[model samples]
Target: MGLIVLRPTRATCVSLACFVVTILCLVSNGPCRAQLSSTFYDKKCSTALGTIQTAVRTAVSSERRMAASLMRVHFHDCFVQGCDASVLLDDTSSSPGEKSAFQNLGSLRGFEVIDSVKSKVEDVCPGVVSCADLLAVVARDASVAVGGPTWTVKLGRRDSMSASQSLAESNLPRATDDLDDLISLFRSKGLNSKEMVALSGSHTIGQAQCITFRPRIYNETNIDDGFASTRRRRCSFTDGDSNLAPLDLVTPNSFDSNYFKNLIQKKGLLTTDQALFNGGSTDDFVTEYSEDRSAFYRDFALAMIKMGDIDPLTGSSGQAQLSSTFYDKTCPRALSTIRADVRRAISREHRMAASLMRLHFHDCFVQGCDASVLLDDTSSSPGEKSAFQNLGSLRGFEVIDSVKSRVQEVCPGVVSCADILAVAARDASVAVGGPTWTVKLGRRDSTSASQSLAESNLPGATDDLNDLISLFRSKGLNSKEMVALSGSHTIGQAQCVTFRQRIYNETNIDAGFARTRKRRCPFNNGDSNLAALDLVTPNSFDNNYFKNLIQKKGLLTTDQVLFNGGSTDGFVTEYSKDRSAFYRDFALAMIKMGDIDPLTGSSGQIRRNCRVAN
Candidate 1:
């Protein structure tokens, strides 16, 4: 019932999801954080978190603004070097520190607070906890110190050995960044547009120096006149650059969604903040969050979890590791073993190819292809299997199970379930008449799953073109790629309940086609009845889905909306005529989809069983 934001799974760092944007920041070279347990120190150092919490609470008690300052320090530290307390380092005789970096100079504070927490923690358990992990906990507690949502901070991350000033200069988003640049910055770290917009809501409780917003208030065209004039009183172009202004004009000390509401009224404090609502892809979500504070809070918590998960040195001593290769020295036959099993499964049941491909989308869209969708329900807690969007609609779990079994025989515990699903999806596409592209391997499986996330993130059959676009756009997929990916409908079938409304009530449907569909899918109820998504060449992987849409024969309303006189109509028309264009774009789009935030290196575990954790 809530707004479901599609969090893209991380792909192998070969290339980013190529979006047509103003700027593209290449993904940082490092393994991302995963497999972190909230109770990581429950046994080793039980009082570790509580000790830090007490210290943080004491610091914030003296100054309410310290909460916001501490939060910013964590964000800046993570953005530069995986939140290893690198930003807390001071300039020494040997090397320059990140504190002197252009983005952090005279901006970052609250280092003494972290030092105090670390001193107390070291006395209780010396070197048992890492600075990187402690910072994550402090960030969560700081949010709750104000009025923001709370989340469990995953532990066991190690501190970085080195820091990069240049990386901070390139990676950290500027206050004057446009929407595209802001999106690229976060996407490079495996977060999405909705997360970017939600995370920006943190500006609600922070203050910005006049130097950060002077240009926007003085020169930007989209700003509200009265709002800009009021801001200029505290900040002047010639002299008051160091003077401070609240990032959110209304209730600047609160942690609500008022920042988004300010954006709607053209009162956003920074250019990057206003850029979210200025006729861009992130506009609708901004409007949604402005009206619904709970939605904003929910998404903000998710974003913090995601941001905290960026490129932690997991299971290692704070070092960047090489990515997984199909033909690795240790796992020589990994790729071949997966390829053989997937071929056998698809050869046995041809329909399983389409089913497997759809399964990959379902897995990746929810929580980054960690095989969480393949999980069956247990007594402890539910999985994604019973979600409204998944329930009985998703198929091909058996094929992935079979592949994992065979893969285990060849290389026990060497291949991860996350990697298996990626390889299977690629091989499944090849089994059908689809294009062949390289599949990036070496993704680890997640220990937990979320049914609520599955329900919110998955696309619905009744979604309009705008909703469809927004859904894909949340994962950095543009309209062209979305239209091309919808070509998957060319090979699948839908239930009668899914398309019954289109046949009976929709005016754009073809007359004869509607009449034919009405026989099986009636006016009243035949919800479980089945209908092929593409009538012409139903099992073929081609442009027929678009061709059918051109004739108003798309089985679901979401599918037909592609050719229903919208911005995406031209893409549908082009693909319907040119098969090669569709194939090329589809392959690229699949690679991009596969690249959604993945669990790489030692971040996640290699589950022996696809359905349950090892």
Candidate 2:
């Protein structure tokens, strides 16, 4: 009944023996794990952890499996190269990536969610947040999302410049691994048998593919007969190899000790899982965890923190900036220069406020907040500025260029054009009587732009309410956020052609409002004519946009559809009555929208000119 060591390599066996000796020495004396601090980012980015938690909670709420997926991402990253974000690297022609390795390709998920978290962190602190640190925080949050223990994740880890497929293939544990091999793998990384048992409890929430456990279910004698039969119903020999079965059938989505309990019952899904309980040295540890959820939670948290501490770059050792004061102390006048230029532009033209806000949205939505929207058309590449949705729709390019010029004069190459856009959009909202929030600094700019991408991403005025919802939902914005962000129409205008069909052909339009619009927008002739989106308070930022929707006076077809017996009607009605609620939610939605994927760290460069790459 005792578990035996499978075919382990000579190197792995020697490494495990060394780790065991090290652990024994540490146990006789005391443990020594350091170099990462929990408060590492407290001053530099106070809201960093909270922001990542919110995103993780939101994503997990939408899909419970996202918790397991995100956890896998952290595990994969740590196993490959000491939690340095090597797994996130994409495969290039010259270098192979870890994402396609044997252990990662079909199993790992949540890269987009990580990218989303990275963007939010960047918006507040910009280049200050490291993708590696972001991954650790996200992993902790994902655990909490699944009703697991919350841990203080030490930060300041930096991203690796390259990934290793070979490392991932060799390091990541397989489902078919034996107990000794699994223990050796964890021990080699400085974790004990108890910690390995607790970490394995994470499988309580996730699922395993049929192919991974088909051998165990059909061929193994250690498995429970009933459990194996139940799994066999869904899995076949040749077909259904890709079918999925929960690791903890008792509560598939809850992060608890149920996985250990299942192993105690001989119902574990994978060979590696059951091997822990097969009269091995780790068997008592597994039994302790199965009987006490608190012990499991505590051990898991410590193990995760230990895993995060492996080979960390630590304070100022890597590309990680320990402080967000980089530009504040280095440039001194960088932010003030951009702010002054933004305020001056908004003072001269009120419409530029809305234009600036739209510019940020356009820039973020296409290729992250890299200021790619500011690039003009060139003979080599027709930039996003002239795309279908941006040709005449987007504005504030001159304002961006002017601000970049002033910032360059004050501190050349210090303030990035991307940061200027993010700051200018925030300043513009405040200039027009909107709620003000602090914008995080340190973003860089992109060298290239995409016209085809812009046309595909930017929503059109003629799009229906469903289209609007789908567009925003694709960017991880829920229905409520979409409604709140659409309120930005209060200070903007729409062209006649954009809404001419609504005025002439749509029945949902208010008769009086349609008649009023038709005066200047007659059928097909005045396609170029303009009309204020929020007629009641065209020059102000308020709840009038939602109120107009309630009255069927919305300028575009997309606007009217929000209130015309649709999913968004309730939000429109709610915003119409409570101005404070509208403002609060609108501000929050803007922050979320501004957090689209962004180029951070050394991925992109700060451009000298807003209109062209440096």
Candidate 2, residues 1-614, lDDT tens digits: the string is 00001111111101122111100000101111225678888998899888888989999999998899888888888765466676776777776778888777777788888877777776777656667787788889989988999898887665555565655665678767777567545654556778888888899998888889988998899999999999998888777877889989999999988898899899999999999999889889888998999999999999999888754433321121212355877688876777788889988988888999889888877655668898888898898988878787678888888888888887887787877887888888888898776665655667778787676667766766655655565454668988888888899887887888889998988899999999999985987788998888787888899988888899888788889998889999999999899889988877665655444455457788888776
- Candidate 1: residue 357 Cα off by (Å): 0.6
Candidate achieving the largest TM-score: 1
What TM-score would every model get versus the actual structure?
A: 0.62, 0.52
Question: By summed lDDT, which 10 consecutive residues of candidate 1 come out lowest?
Answer: 1-10
Off by over 4 Å in 1: 1-314, 317-349, 408-413, 465-470, 473-478, 563-570, 602-608
Judge candidate 2 against the unseen true structure and give its global Cα lDDT, from 0 to 1.
0.74
RMSD of each: 9.9, 19.7
lDDT of 1 at 441: 67
Q: Ten-residue segment with the worst summed lDDT in candidate 2?
A: 21-30
True lDDT of residue 520, candidate 1? 84
